[model samples]
Target: MTTSFETLYQNLQAAVDDELQTLLCHHQPRLLWESMAYSVLGGGKRLRPLLCLLACEAVSGKWQPALPAAQAVELIHAYSLIHDDLPALDNDDWRRGKPANHKEYGEDIAILAGDALQTLAFQLLSDPAIRRPDVQVRWVAELAGAAGPMGMCAGQVLDLHAADSVWKEAEILDVYRRKTGALIRAAVRMGALAGGAGPEQLQALTGYAEDLGLAFQIVDDLLDLTGSFEALGKTPGKDLMQDKKTYPALLGQAEARQKVESCLLRARDVLFSVPLLQTGHLLQIAEKLVHRET
Candidate 1:
């Protein structure tokens, strides 16, 4: 099953890469597209898009139909990362083992690239090939709500406050849900919806995504303190240097590790409740994401 999953993942990853490059054409303004391409084409796991396709397969057994939705989520993710690494934000210079977009391109170009990526995401969903206006509207709204001011943006605001205030566990978790989990939830929800999931099935998958998203963040928190620059593909100790309130900071290494384990188990149990024959991939993804070293 693992070997089969690996093969399937590689196939799907290749398809996403191809379509992503095809999405942005070589147009009159060369620099705009170039800056956007720099970060989107740069190396990363493509986890959100893969999760969307996998969720679709679990529901409909036809991931290909959900490919555009998968692409949309990835574009939104790429845009968020670009903005997150900007000087006014996280102020990081490295991403996916390369210079951040703002550094390689000028800050002005990087900002515009991020904007283009964000709007293009909606453009992809709005494609007539999707064949359903309602679904298109829902997808556009889903991605927007997840990435918009009330979602990831709201989380960013809370995170900035973490630097100055000592936070309770709940407070820190609130930030994680907004900063990391909202888009993850939207990815799974959009995929399942595209796959024609019923209410109960959608509920189950949503529960799974919420738990897995929290676990993913906790693991990232652990990695930031213990992982190396090479393994992480970016500076690892920024959280500490920035005095960012993270799970490890509040619970310590042992407790934080245990928290991740609990979340993963809950995610798995929630996934199991979903009546589907093809949930093996989502289950594996939850385990792999939480247990990943880099």
Candidate 2:
């Protein structure tokens, strides 16, 4: 029997949502909690969490063991989004078809909520339910490295400055790798690591993720031009408005799309080169995301 990717995605998404609610709800200071929940529970494709779970299954034939890691990645993603949409950052209102968190709540509350969500991610990864002390340590290190200075943070800073500057392809790629690719690669790596993958298996999956990550970012840039606000569940053309550096901005639509295809081809080839990877869902996800409007 073939596993339905949409079904698995829905199921995993529900599980992650439930787990996040359980972990986040019922805390003190109802307003702060509400803001945090608002930021996370706002609808968006749970891509990072799904990648974490599916990568674990691909390596070990089980996704359940990586649930906590899935939640952690999603939380980290939510935190990033909350801050990304702030006044001093991307500076536009509306996320997921509604007001951004800072707009819905006050900026002060939104900032605190993002901070809390960031810490909550570590809390999820460090919980006793993870069942392995060393694994907990490793996940903590991986996620932190991915989200911290040299990874997503650095990318965002570089992107901020580059908004008003010109960047070559390599420089643009560096920002994309750090800003978007780092967490994505980390999500896959943490999942595979949780599944106890051998070094070769880890290396292969990492390669696939690297290529997939680039494709994902390029697609995001494409969607900004091609997707409707209703379809994207966020404002489109923000990139153009800010004059942000992106593949489409630098490479032209035809070349940027070609790059996306090239990246996807390499991603699949890396998966093919490795043996013993039950990564059908991962492959499906790459194809789906390449064509995704949201």
Candidate 3:
């Protein structure tokens, strides 16, 4: 019998957790490690890492080799959240239902923790353990491209600019594509590359990531509008409070959900064409992304 998606996800999450623990186990400076451990270990869906592992398994038929890449992407995500929550940015006081990293650890430690996780992600990727030197370098570039100026950071700048400003749909979507979609796109491509995917397969996976990423962000906007803090592990209504650009703000709740459904269909179509035995997990995830309460 085929394993269920939930079971597969639980197993993958466990592996990623183990890998993260091993990577940070022996680090020096108790405060830094403490902050790192607190932020990194803080619980969430692990969606990005799971995407990497699933894409790897879909192409290569195993998730083990992709663990390092999965861990790297997750660390980048954690670091981003840390920095995003600081007084300089979103100024959120809670995450995963606990005090935000900056609130609990102080701004200096929070900043250093984010920096450490970002650098450590590269350090982990550069290790010979995951892939060959050439392949490792390629993976690093992929991640950097997604997380750096042209990708997530660019989106963040646009978001900041959008505050107290009227935004066009194109502008909002551009932010979505760069900020959230970039890293997700990297996750899929990194997995495919690690699994020896050719150009055609890579292109297909990229298309899937694009749709999935947009849908994911749209749902996030919806959640911020409709979901409870307990469910989201962060403040709700912040988008409206800050006048942030978002799908629901521009498209309305009903239209935003419709857009997510359309994206989900596109994602499902691309993912199903890949001819992987493990495609169900992705399809199910797409469904969840559109339908999830949080």
Candidate 4:
């Protein structure tokens, strides 16, 4: 029987979680590990890691070989969230329905935890167990590029600047591309590369990832406005409170939802255009992201 998307997601999430738990258990210094694990093991969608695994499977690569990369992306994602919630950034008091790392563990510990997780991601990528050195090298570069100055960090910088001024549509989109979409695109590409996908297939996945990323941000904007604290696991209406530039701020709620639908359709088109072995899970993921209540 074909595995359902929910089943596949649950299995992959468990696998990634186990890997993180094992890694943390072996690390020295109990408090540091505890802080890192607190943010990592906390409730999350695990979307980046899941996308990595699914992309690997879609490219006919054994997903097991890509597990390290998947884990690495999640680590980077978790670290980003930790830092993003700091007072210097978004100043969020809660995440995933729990106290923010900074609030729960104090600002200093939270900063260190984020830094440690970021470095650990690179460590995971460098592990010799992940198959070919060439693939490993590519994975390292892909992930670093996505998470560093050229991608997510740059987006954060843009976000900081935007707080002081009104942003154009293009500028907001650029922030979305780098801040949210870059790592997601890298997750898909890294998985495909690990699976030995060709240039054409990689390009298709890139397009699909980019659209999905935009849809994700748009949905996020919608949720911040329309969702509740119970559903989002974080404070609602934060965007408006912070005066952050968002799709809903620029396009309005109905228009933002419409935009998400459009982006999802385009993403689906790109995903189906490629000759993937199994794309149902990816399609479902895209749909869930676009229409998610939280």
Candidate 5:
């Protein structure tokens, strides 16, 4: 039988897919448009954008107004992935079952593409048609915090340093939270702020995002162990090869799964304090994330 989480995930996925298509079609550049489109439109779970939309809905804001922000979050995510696949980083040869951006387009173009996408995210946030200047500034700051030295970038540095070293579970969580969870949390906060959430509401959603983000990383770790390339759409077992710390490495597989479940439950509990009707989709997403195969 299909679970409620699966049903909600499909609905959110459809919405995110449509939004991404519309945004990509509308935005064009003089050069490397094709590469930019390929990077942005590549197949992956639209988790960041979905979080934006859900956070908007959770705070009684019109979700439509946050679509641009959602697109911006996704652009940032795409940029990170593009850079992550570079030879200097993960050295990945494939992504989503296709040649890596650097491999397909050449490293120079791939780097430029990522740079352009990162800038484009700010442009999207600043578009006068989409958001007020104040909101734009706030959202841009949030994005910068999540993507720059103090956030995802820092996490990546930690990840590189930890390679071939034994790391405690806390250290692993610290790295994942910064590298992965920071942007995820930013996505949620940006959506909530755009949706007119007050400080209190934002606080609750922040907690929810934290739990959800950690659970996401844990699930990713689990998939690396249990999934195949066909199902994962990327190389599995790469973490093990790299000797990177992961939830499953620190905690046993069974314990890691339990941790994910616990995190999802905590996320749900936090969301439950809000009006159930307002947070239904967000709650559904937290549950669905834990159980996703890819």
Candidate 6:
């Protein structure tokens, strides 16, 4: 029997592929479209969209209604990765076993592609297909807050600054909360709201998402220490070389693993308290995140 996470992952990938292909079908400058497709279609786990779909289902909302929003989340995620891999940023040469966007495409095209994807996210959200105008507006606002200077961008800035300084664990946690946790938390909350969750349920699910996000980052840090480039689909040990603070760097490998476990436990506990049936899939996602090889 297929596990719930496996099934959900397949479904999420299908949805993402469909949405992305539709976006790519439009006639545009070939170079721009190809660059956009390269960054977006480069294999990814599609975790953000999965969270959106599951969160919607958890609230008894139809998953179809949340598809646009899910696609929006994914676009935003792809845009972030494209920018993150830029020479000015992480300077990564590989993503999902392929050359990073800027490495394959010119740096200018890659930057433009990232910008286009970011704008497309909002365009997707604003489409009439997504029901509830108020919900869509709120979702856009939330996503903006998470992706902008006050959130992930700010976290990246802090990371760059911390490259030359000794950062405490708390400071590192703050950076991850913004860089990684913000989008993740937004994905969950947006899913819940799209599914028409009550305020209380949303609150509980947010807690679950937040814990899971932290655990995900902790595991990512651990993987960087031990995983091979082939298994990781990106450069490992980059964080250490960059002098960026990570959970493993601050807490030691064993302690970092323990922290991931603790966070996953807390996420599961939060799920248990919620009445949403989709919590089963959320728990599975949390497990997969910690155990993922790539």
Per-residue lDDT tens digits for candidate 3, residues 1-294, read: 135777877888899998888877846788899899898898988989989988888788887777888999999999999999997888899999999999888999999999999999999899976548877888899999999999999999899889767888888999999999999999988888777787777888899999999999999999998889989999999888888989889879999989988988898788766566567777776676668887
Give the candidate number with the greatest TM-score.
1
Angstrom error at residue 132, model 3: 1.2
Better of 2 and 3 by TM-score: 2
Instruction: Please provide, for model 4 over 35-148, each residue's C-alpha lDDT reduced to its tens digit, 9 standing for 90 to 100.
Output: 999999987998998889888888984677678899999999999999999999998999999999999889999999999999999998988875589999999999999999
What is the TM-score of candidate 6?
Answer: 0.96
**Where does candidate 2 stray beyond 4 Å?**
1-3
TM-score of each: 0.97, 0.97, 0.96, 0.96, 0.93, 0.96
lDDT of 5 by residue, 83-177 (tens): 99998988889899999888888898899989988998998898888637877898999999999999999999999878767788999999989
**Native-referenced Cα lDDT, model 4:** 0.89
- lDDT per residue for candidate 1 within 207-268, as digits (tens), equals 98888889899899899999998999898899999899999999899999899989888888
User: What local distance difference test score does each model get?
Assistant: 0.89, 0.89, 0.88, 0.89, 0.85, 0.86
Candidate 1: worst-modelled 10 consecutive residues by lDDT: 268-277
Where is model 6 more than 4 Å wrong at Cα? 1-5
Q: RMSD for each model, in Å, please?
A: 1.1, 1.5, 1.6, 1.6, 2.2, 1.4
- Model 1, residue 4: C-alpha shift (Å): 0.9
| Comparing 1 and 5 on TM-score, the stronger one | 1
Residue-wise C-alpha lDDT for candidate 2, range 1-294, written one tens digit per residue: 136778888898899899988988757898999998997887878888888888898889998888888899999999999999998999868889889999999899999999999998998889897679988898999999999999999999999999667689999999999999999999998998888888888898899888888999999999999899888878899999888999899989999999999999998888777674586898898888887768
User: Where in model 3 is the C-alpha error above 4 Å?
Assistant: 1-3
Backbone N/Cα/C clashes per model: 0, 0, 0, 0, 0, 0
